[model samples]
Target: MSTVKVNDATLERINELKEKLKISKTLILEIAVGNYHSKFFKKKEDP
Candidate 1:
């Protein structure tokens, strides 16, 4: 179990996207964090 604090603006945006996309907030965060991880943490291959 873990806890994270989100700012007001980001929280509001998440709520808006939740209603518009009709997805759970947990799913939204998961997608976002997964994307962020893939963007930054991907392994590089030597060419």
Candidate 2:
């Protein structure tokens, strides 16, 4: 599980970007999760 905290201004910006790019909430969330995973695992060298 992950938790994100955004201020009102940031939330508005995200909403605006979502509308402008025509992206859905699900896609945004997936991208965020993928990014988080990559960052979290970046220190471990792959075999």
Candidate 3:
């Protein structure tokens, strides 16, 4: 596990989502990172 520091606003949002979705903070971050990677990073086709 890694420790990350987040601003108050971000922490508030994360907590809101966690309560709304009934998921853990770690899963919230994981899903967010996955979405970010999918949106910003393209996968290269294998030759």
Candidate 4:
């Protein structure tokens, strides 16, 4: 639906991962975003 701009090297890495991992670019990006969110944004809640 929307777009984000990435550098040439980053795009190339993404393409390489897409082929090697046999996964869609969308999924690759989704996982990357999820990991990033967990690492930097989300806080661990104590039970």
For residues 1-47, write the lDDT of model 1, one tens digit per residue.
55888899999998898787765766899999999878676654323
Candidate 2 lDDT over 6-44, as tens digits, reads 899999999899796776777888999999999878857
Positional deviation of 23 in candidate 1, in angstroms? 6.6
lDDT of 3 by residue, 1-47 (tens): 76987899999998898797766766889999999888666654333
What's the TM for model 1? 0.40
| Model 1 segments more than 4 A misplaced | 1-23, 43-47
Which lDDT values do the candidates have, in the order given?
A: 0.80, 0.84, 0.80, 0.81
Give the per-residue lDDT digits (tens) of candidate 4, residues 1-47. 65987899999999898797876766889999999888765465432
In terms of lDDT, the poorest run of 10 residues in model 1 is: 38-47
Cα error, residue 12 of model 4, in Å, equals 26
Instruction: Say which candidate scores most in TM-score.
Output: 2
Provide the global lDDT of candidate 4 against the true structure: 0.81
Task: Give the clashing residue pairs of candidate 3, or none.
Answer: none
**In model 2, where do residues sit more than 4 Å from their true spots?**
1-23
